[model samples]
Target: MTATNVETTRVVRTSWLPLIVVVLTQIQASFAVNALTVSMAGITTDLDTPATSVGTAITAGTFGMAAFILLGAKIGSRFGTRGVFQIAVVIHGLAMLGVALSVSPTMLFIAQASSGAVIALIAPALTVFIATNYHGEQQGKAIGLLAAAIPAAGVLALLLAGWFANTIGWRWSFVLMVGLALINLLLSFRLKRVPAQPGLSIDWAGAILAAIAVILLSFGFSGLATWGVVLATPQAPFEVLGISPAPILIIAGLIVGQAFFMWLRRRAHEGLPRIFDLRVLATGSERAVTACMATMLFVGTAANFLIPLYIQVVQGRSSIETSFAIIPYTLSIFLSSTFVAYLYGRFAPRVLATAGFVVVASALTLLAFTVRGEWSQAFVVAGLILLGLGQGAIVALVFNTLLSAAPKQLAGDVGAWRGLVHNLSGSVGIAVASAFAVGILASSIATSAAEHPEISDELIAQVNLDEVNFITNEALAELLATRASGPELDAAIAVNAEARLHALKISLLSLAAISLLAIVPATRMPRQRAGDLPEKLEPDDDDLIDPVDEQEALG
Candidate 1:
């Protein structure tokens, strides 16, 4: 049988069940991350660690995924997609179980990292499954559903995990994930099995380079707050020639990252198997789509992290309140992601993307100016809704553009690239936001205290201002109660309050600036509507054989 006939037969046999399974897997992975965010207060209290520790755990999971996702795509190609996906599902469930049983910060980080590494196997396989089982409009809709699954998972995690944390315990959230993972595994039997490429060779050297680069970057950024941005701090584990190791690590990561790309280019020149296909990003439009994607995710994830940190940690609110506060935002993301496909035919991707970034920047600016200490302000809700609408639209649009730009054979590469950027940008976003906010807070507190008459210079000297971090008003009060009283205590509390709010405003404004800059990339996107573009076909599309045809040939 001809390859065209084989493709036709496969499309004819496609079912929505596979899409459902894929979406569920996405939810399962996303829920783990979101649950950690919601349960931050509980985890910090239970583990006797600071909130930054929990943030570090979250970064670890994303970092692990970003580090290995390229290798994972190749692994999916070498082994059967179905088999690898099934095993990944089961392993992820075990990881979730480990999270539920974790007794320390180290244990939590290890468990989350394991879950993330396993997700590397599942993410690319999902895209390959859609490519093999669906065609044309169905494929588009499937992609939309898959993109929507992230925010949809966020909504579920906020509600369910919040309730679990408030009532039973935070650990129950991952226990629930374990149950959901089993259900996802059971549903996997219904998905179409895509044949593996036995001839595909693994690029172990390239994988090592990529992994080391990502790890260095993740740890470096995450440590900036504790280790000092530019100078060495007392909290730093070690100094490099009187300089903070954080910036040094970041520089090393960049150099290693450049080496990894150079290695890939050399491999491409030699016609050797590369870790990732450079062709996926060969065009200007494709590179623009990637830039836009990374920017939106960086801004969105930073906002997401900052909001919860303020609500639960700084404000000392319950998980349930934090969940309810962001309902409008998460719902907007779900709605926009699900329905943005309809807008594709009416507007060019560039128009939609530009408008999306504008909305996001405007929303962030609104948030910067309007947010006080209160989470219930009408403007705050409006800002969140607008932010979600813009973020969701841009996310869906970019993913659709990316998938359409590549041929079916490179589906795994596309998926891996998308996953790498999505998680890496997100991890960096959270790390940078945390570091920036804390850095600002420390500086603001010192300045405010020095200006206050009641807060004497001796009092400031007694407390290590350099070690300052985001703390609740109540905690600050308790800490100062023994040394300060009456006017002094009041002054110290006021300084903390004002400094926290100022830090938040500055962070939001910074994010808004990033959102505006993303518009430049959006302008470089394709002017044509995604639906109007023709499908990109591989050069060997006619010569390629499907799994069934190849099996027949072997027989």
Candidate 2:
């Protein structure tokens, strides 16, 4: 290109409208997930299903997205981002309607899973679009806004779902998602399109292998709260060497996950089409971004799940109350995310990301100590502020790093990787937190019962303390109502309360330890300040490879 053409391209002002539309996609995706958490009680009651079943719907969404996100990248590369995004938006809208109209648990599963699949097609489109359309400071700002929008949408979803579930119904929360997707679909018409790679081929073998690994891992994680993690529980259909089947599934997933990497290597050396480009993660900087993304997501998802759980299950409060409790935390995330991106200019990723991890760990530790049966909201809010400040800043920095490092052509691959990281981490985080909390609850109850004669062994045996169960005080009272009476029953109830509080504190401490461990990886991040020019990947010549022939190779 001549200097004149380069000057022309540089001078062209990117429209903010397109960025807004792309950000909407980010917002809508996060909103659906957060809304489901706050709406859990209403959905389960309406469908006459167990609470775990309602939670599974969320897990199923993550599985569906993880399974197809890589393929979504291939589809986008073949069909064009703009076309796929528009069509995906339409499909998402219809799926949201199915979700809202679900009459049974079975229907809810189908609707949520379908919605997740369609979302995979659109999720990658937004990041790729932003990375392709904007550059330099503008690109940095766009990535910041996208990160902020997720939490912002989360706040909106919680508030809306709370209000709707209290007044209209939980179903309307989904109806709102349909409306948002439709609006985005209309706005997407104005987006700039890339010419499709007509001969693009899908790596079906690698795709299937990766998908199964993700699905098994995700399912195992989700079941931790229902099925025992190590020892066999009643819920397990069978046991291996007297161990719970949940851990077995997780072990299988890890082996399959290794198999996926091996297959990718074999394909690369054997001259087959690679599903995931190894080059995207060739640098330490890119890997740092991935590490930071997973760590922050795990902390964030675990915290988010715990908040609603405490308000609804422990405190016996309504969904609206859960939203009210989340305001301080969600608000902090939104506000901090808006300003955090500006820090990139002055601070290195190593410094910023490490500091972010520290803040999160400290906040989690604070919650662990301060939380009680009758918690003080003021202390929780203070901790949330600290958590949000760190989380918001790190998300922007890591995202901007990836965008600036890679060339425009690899935008689809970058998005696919992001979707995979987020979905997997989120599923794992929620599952592990739930499992940890429930495990503690059962153990604490057993220990207290064994020591205190008032809460006798006979009384403990009446309840299924061997299984994973996170129930409200009300539920405990109701369960004991039929089986016990007098001071013994009352003592048992007191023990349950103490056990519940102890479980929450211990589980939060565990999460804090994980967040602190993330500091080790964060230290390896690039020391370059955000203002420095990134080593950009030069785009490959698109005309060199045609997908029509198997022998035609990608440079």
Candidate 3:
């Protein structure tokens, strides 16, 4: 056979097989993670925990995911892709079972943290395998498919979780994940072992420092009130690692970590992997990808987290009704992500992202205008649809840009970085929105109290402005019933309206500004043809392989 013919045949064999495995694994993994959210309320009730405590547990997963992603990358480098992935899959299954069995909230939280790290491992290795196996448009499509899988999983999760929550309980809902994990494991056997680059010893100092910085910063964001309380009142809430309002201290640690890691990398000739790879951040493409991912999460999360509260509290809807109301967002995310992904292949990522953000910002503006004490289902659906479409477009564009910008040699590490940015962005976005909402509510309540001299300070302090605003105005209605005169009721109504509107506007507008941040970085991406490169016939031929696999194959 001609040399060209042999090469062509090998390329065809290498590309399609691994590509399918990567896309499927990513989808399944995403589905597993998203499934948890659907049962969150149930879990809170079962564990007898407050909503805020439950939120902390969920956010802890992000912290663990971000903190250990580099560790996963290092594992992949040392043990090879297949080894790390198999181990991660097992860990995932075990963690799910552990979570399901937990009678104590602490145990469940720990289980989630462990599963988070496992996810970090699996995701990076999957991306590395895909990057090595596919090129050009093939690669773009594979990533797009992964992005689409997120919402697909969300749809499945919400449906099943809701059903299971009603029939069995939240515990059983988590238990169901074990079966999915086993199926994923069975399918994972088809995945080929990808080789690791040699001479990549893990940088111990860098790893520790980076992990510390990430955990501290993530906790800081997740526990902003704790941090803020520490700042505002010396005796406020609990402090972690003896640091409260430790923003300055945390920032200092991050700088030190960066410097130490850089020094270690400079001496990499002596054998240090430099786990976080600060050099990657220096590149415009990497920064753009990171920013784009963060911005997408910022807008999407704000919209998603807020609307459920709005429906349940403001509109006095039931849990089922609230979920149904938000279905538009979930449905639109799946459909829009799939559609926009194709568009991303045809045009510059910037174009899609910019247009999407504008649509979302416009939706938020409309929502701010129409969101009232009484809202129609149509109005809520319309806003959700707009938000969903915009998020879908943003997600597709960012994933496409990140993959294109990443170099093949460092794809695993880059993938880890991408995951880190994605989760961190989500945590920070939600935190910022929550903080702004709380601030607005507090300010409004203060103003309301001052105007209504009849309302006692004790009553004002007892009122959970945050919980009440998020819940049905029925809570406010109870308060209003105390007043007999029409003018008194009018005053209360005006105060409530102003407070809710202010909170919603600030949340939406802040997210809009965050989305705008993505526009600048996205412009740096090259408008490349999607699926322009042919599939690889033998992707793993060049990747690092497990020594055991190498020896067996040679035999």
Pairs of colliding residues, candidate 2: 199-547
Residue 65 lDDT in model 1?
93
Question: Across residues 223-248, which tens digit of lDDT does each residue of candidate 1 receive?
Answer: 88788888989989999888999899
How would the candidate models be sorted by lDDT, starting from the highest? Answer: 1, 2, 3
Better of 1 and 2 by TM-score: 1
Per TM-score, the best of the predicted structures is: 1
lDDT of residue 112 for candidate 1: 91
lDDT of 3: 0.64
| Candidate with better lDDT, 1 vs 3 | 1
lDDT of 2 by residue, 27-140 (tens): 777777888888877887799766666667777787778878988877776778789888888888888898899999878878887888778888877776766677677877
Deviation from native of the Cα of residue 289 in model 2, angstroms: 3.2
- Residue 462 of model 1 has an lDDT of 89
Mark the 10 consecutive residues where model 2 has the least summed lDDT: 546-555
For model 3, the superposed segments whose C-alpha errors exceed 4 Å read 1-28, 31-36, 102-105, 132-138, 195-199, 226-253, 260-272, 276-279, 312-319, 373-376, 461-502, 529-555
How many Å off is the CA of 266 in candidate 3? Answer: 3.4
Q: Which ranges of candidate 2 are over 4 A from the true structure?
A: 1-13, 237-243, 374-376, 406-409, 528-555
Error of 3 at 538 (Å): 16
Model 1 lowest lDDT segment of ten: 545-554
